[model samples]
Target: MKVLAAMSGGVDSAVAAARAVAAGHDVTGIHLALSRNPKSYRTGARGCCTIEDSNDARRAADVIGIPFYVWDLSDAFHEEVVEDFMAEYAAGRTPNPCLRCNEKIKFAAVLDRGMALGFDAVATGHYAQLRTGDDGMIEMHRALDHAKDQSYVLGVLTQEQLAHSLFPLGDTTKDVVRREAADRGLLVADKPDSHDICFIADGDNAGWLREKLGDRNPNTGGDIVDSATGEVLGHHEGTVGFTIGQRRGLRLGVPAPDGKPRFVLDIEPVSGTVSVGPRAGLQIDRITGIRPRWCGTVPEVLDGPAVTVQLRAHGAEHRAVVAVRPAGASSEGAPMGVASDGSGSGSVEIELLEPAEGIAPGQAAVIYDGSRVVGSATISGTGRSHALAQTLQRVAT
Candidate 1:
């Protein structure tokens, strides 16, 4: 097999590429140069594809004795991942940029280019397992190291992408992978794993967004209103500075009547309103998802054993019953009619058996049947449990 190994200058990817070579595959390594100005992104061990990272990848490739090259994906990455991140945040929604990068840049752009060059598959360091099911379709599953599993981010991949993808480190733990890297003489063996958004040089997301958005920012300042009282408790520099679950750094001048800490319940970008309330208001039992992407066969409905949905990249899974239908379909057994926001994409309605908290729109909801990924969808809306809604209503009255 001709494998195109994506070496990210990290221990996992270096070991993955090495393992691919040891398996007798004709492996060629490549590092994605995602930023046009490499210095603008994170440097040192905190970065993923910085200039230093590219050099590290090259060295790792040399150690593995494989042909290596750097692909300039800056333009594609900027339009797809970076722009999309700002746009999602501007619309008052929280998005996972890593998921977007995997969907648009890694699998879509890189895979297409690799196949054009006659490569059979593109392997990465992602900790997610792939297997052929009874139907002979490629099925993605959780990695052996549950703590390091990254299947949630890779959930956006389609059946075709999964077919041409290889994840060699999926069955191994992080410690073992690092040990293998050291044994194989890869220097990145001890490099700390990159955290936070790669493109953001500093971890301050709000400041970065404010500077990048500039004139396009909807509101320079807005009121942080209490949901229960509709009273303006404080003001914010921007609605993008807050997210659904945020409880700290609110700088609210007024305390809640109940004296309980308030969590951001909602963000209305157009109205410049950030609603705060008791944590109970954050509980939601239903999620409406758009742009459903299936890993293999698309099921009409998923229920019973192993049916679950993960809302965040590393968040716990919620046992759920999911129903798939065309966008704008009737709300039958689901909580609401799934709308595609005029994109005409398919929709997924997920009913969590147990309620989830602080679920925000624009986040990916990856559905699974036990270890195998069924599909994923972008969350568009959420609904509180009826009982909870009634309780809140009573409290309000």
Candidate 2:
């Protein structure tokens, strides 16, 4: 197979590209230039899209004896991932920018260009496995190292993309990968891993937003309302700084029955209201997601099949019954029934057997059957089921 290996100038990508070459595939390396003006020197350890990273990638490609080139996708990255991230935060919703990057730039843009250039697939350092089943469909699964599992970030990939995707670091642990890179004489064997959002240079999220969207704070000095009494508790900087389940940084004076810190239950960017309540209010039983994307095979219908649901990246997974919610169904109301035959307006609902916390709207809910990722969607809204629903009526208000 003619493969295009995406080198991130990291040990993982270098090793993945070398493995692809070792497999006797016609491999070429392409480094994505996401930043228009990449910094000359590394700002601490954030080396994701730096100019140094591209240089490291070129050096690694030289070591692997493969042709290397850098593709500039800064415009697309700024529009799709960075701008959308700011917009989502302004709307008081937490979004996964990493997943968005994988969906739009890497797989969609790069894979399309690679295919047009006669490359069979685009290989990456993602910690995911691709298995060919008897049905001849490539099934994506979790990596062998659970700590470095990146399947969550790549959940938005569809069947077509997975068909042309390769993750050579799947079955190997991170330690082994680094050792192998060292053995192969790769310079990035001891390179530090990049953390946080790449674009946010200083690694401060709210600070970066304030610097970027100056004088246009989402909260606009709005009142923080108490969920129980509907009374104004305090004020906040902006809604962008607060997530759904965040407990600290709220600085609300409201004291719980047990004297615990109040957690942020909801944030209304339209009304500029931040609702604070007890930690129990964060428990979510039902999650409704929009714009669902599948991998390997698109099931004709998802008739309430049991699957595991991961709400946040690197967060805990819970047992859930996955189904399609109706079109006319209210986003504020609990899902009434399932939309059978997989014929719906691209909405998905996951009912957790054990209630999960921190289910914020605009987050991605990646569904899995065992180790294989079935599909994923952006969380539209969440609700409590059974007896807990009545007690949490304050959530609707």
For candidate 2, list the clashing residue pairs, or say none. none
Candidate 2 ranges beyond 4 A from true positions: 40-42, 215-219, 300-306, 325-345, 390-397
What does each candidate score in C-alpha RMSD?
Answer: 3.7, 4.9
Local accuracy by lDDT, each model: 0.90, 0.84
lDDT of 1 by residue, 1-397 (tens): 9999998898889999999999899999999999999988787775396888998999999999999999999999999999999999999999999999999999989999999999999999999999999999899999999999999999988888999999999999999998998999999999999999999998899999999999999988899998877999999999889999899999998888879899999999998999999888898998999888888776789999789999999999999999987644455643233222112277888999988999999999999999999889999999977876787679767
Kindly give the stretch of ten consecutive residues in candidate 1 with the minimal lDDT sum: 335-344
Model 1 compared with the native: what TM-score?
0.94
Candidate 1 Cα errors over 4 Å, as ranges: 328-344, 391-397
**RMSD of candidate 2 to true structure, Å:** 4.9
Q: How many steric overlaps are in each model, in order?
A: 0, 0
lDDT of 2 at 124: 98
Tens-digit lDDT string for candidate 2 (26-45) = 99999999986777213543
